[model samples]
Target: MLERFIAITADFSIIIPFIYLLFKGKIPLTISDKLIYVYIVLTLIRNIASFVTMMLGVYNIYLYNWYNLLSFGIIAALYFQILNNLYFKMLVIAALILLIAIAFIDYRTLLNVRTTEFNRFSFNASGCFTILFILFFLYELIRKLQVKKLTEYPLFWFSSGALLYYSGTIFPYIFIQYTFNNLANRDLYWIIDAVLSIVLSVFLCFSIRHMKHQKTV
Candidate 1:
């Protein structure tokens, strides 16, 4: 019961940023800003769907599979926009394409035997790529010394939040199948994931709330 409550709360916590951005009354002009907006909305939709499916006791692994692909695409696009290097941009595009293909193949190959199981391959790949992107962005930020105050930088918060969540969850997600087979392990995984998710949402809220102060790269 506690686990369920925490998971539900974390899922709905996304509304914090969603509402903040919606009534803030400022249009997202930059590609990164727009991508952030889209990513939040997409996450909200996925969470809602996940909640409903959970209530209905329906198979919902596919929702996560789709969410992982779309979220990675949006995030990769944001990094592509912010990163100045042509090679990094090309790498992002390639990673996005590879992720899509991997997701497609994983879904098709496992649809029969693992309809209810998490898409571990795609999830781990996306998580690793996201971490890599965050690291690359941070490296570029430090190398260029563009922003004097890292806290004031919006993408800094975004990247940090993403890094925290993805890095924290990658190992558990990689072993999700094993975790799911054991009830106690599964509950622990969800609780940890939920906690990290709440932290990520808070960081996203900060990121969007400070959009007005966003510095160009």
Candidate 2:
């Protein structure tokens, strides 16, 4: 019963931000804001596809692998847009290239072994890179002190959401194979992931809603 509730919540939570965006009837003007909207739309599509594949008992791990790459690329672009430091932007560019290459190689290697298995290395690598990006953003945010009210800042909410979700899930993803082989409750890790996803979605909703009020960062 709890698992079903979590699954349903996690699946539908993303819609909240979409609905809020529609309700506002205002398009985001900045590149960073636009990227966030794109990320949300893609995430919703991925969730639907994942759910459909699961219902059909299909191997959906590949979907997540693809999504990991796409998600990292989008978020990296977002940080690149918002960050002012030339050095940080260059670092983002370099990290994006290297990480995507490594992730693609990892994906191809895993495809040869078993398509059904999780792309653990790619997922974890993306999480690590994303965490670093968030830290860079936060450091810049502190140094600049542009926004007096940080809560009203869209990137703050977005970065907070990403940080919580990635930091919470990376360890579980690392040990997922062990959990599957040895643990009685394999769903435990996924439940945690779902909860964090829901939290992230809520934060994204806040970020989207605040876009009109706050100047693009």
Candidate 3:
């Protein structure tokens, strides 16, 4: 119950920046901003739905797999907009292949969306893919060698949030089964997850705030 409470708190915290966006409708967001907006909203709805379904004793975790797939696609597009490197393009292709394979596997393994199981393959592959893209995104930034402070750059904050999240989550989520069997005392791991989530939320808010400031300046 405590774990669920923490998860819900972190999940709902995402809407804070989204609410800011809604209130500042006059502010135009870049394509990347729009993508992040959609991602956050989808995540918020999925979280709320997951909680409701959990309370009703229904199968709903599968919904998150769909969210994961869609989030990858949108983030891929965002990266495509940010840089035009061949490797990044190939990374997008590989990610697409993995997404399709994961979806196919789920469809074949489960007759319907009613199971306690999670798609480990897709989930892990996504973690790895995100890490790669973030590394590339960071390298791209380094190559440019921008003179501006990192904090003032919106993309820097956005990419940093993603980097911290995927990299932080890779081990815990991928080895969750092993963790449960070997390490029963896993509260510390969850605390890390919660911290990463809050950081992502804060960075996202900063990214938008910086974007708004950039536009006005």
Candidate 4:
């Protein structure tokens, strides 16, 4: 019960920034900003869909997994915009492939009543997104070459958040996948994911704030 409470708190906290952005006067149109907006909208829709499914007791987690894939896609796009380098185009391609794979897996869930096979596919597909996610930051750190570049732009926070999150999640997620054991301690790992979400959302909100300030200056 406490974990659920904490999860709700963390989830709602992350949603606050998107809520603020949605109601703010005009939407941001820069490639990065628009992508964030789309991500935010998709997150909201996914949550709503989740709630409906849960109320119906449908037991479908793939819906939420697809949401995660889309979120990762947006993150990859955001990173590319920040780095704005030709080499990052490869990362974009990887992100697209990840997205397509997840979509195909998700579509299978609807076609077949049995979800276990689809769940397995969804699980690995989400992992693939995480792999791409970790690669994006690794590439960023390697190719950027200038430490000062991390500080010069607003998207830096998004990049840093990704780094922190990718670090926190990659091991646990992979471990669970390989072990294939339904350990009793599984819920504990959600704390890592939740913390990352809260941290990333706060950083993203500040980054947007910084960008807004720059526009007026």
The top-ranked prediction according to TM-score is: 1
* lDDT minimum window of 10 residues, candidate 3: 177-186
Top of the candidates by lDDT: 1
User: Candidate 4: lDDT of 42?
Assistant: 78
Candidate 3 residue lDDT tens string, 132-201? 8878888877777652577887777878998899888888778755542233545557666777877888
Between which residue pairs do clashes occur in model 2? Answer: none
Q: What tens digits encode model 2's per-residue C-alpha lDDT throughout 60-135?
A: 7677778888899999999988777799889888988887777766665345433656665677778888999999
RMSD of 4: 4.6
Backbone Cα, N, C clashes tallied per candidate: 0, 0, 0, 0
Give the lDDT of residue 147 in candidate 2. Answer: 85
Deviating ranges (above 4 Å) for candidate 1: 109-114, 180-184
Model 1 clashing residue pairs (backbone): none
Rank by TM-score (best first): 1, 2, 3, 4
Q: What is the TM-score of each candidate against the true structure?
A: 0.91, 0.90, 0.85, 0.71
Ranking by lDDT: 1, 2, 3, 4
Q: lDDT tens digits, residues 18-73, model 4? A: 76775566744567667766766776677666667767988555665556666777
Worst 10 residues of 1 by lDDT: 108-117
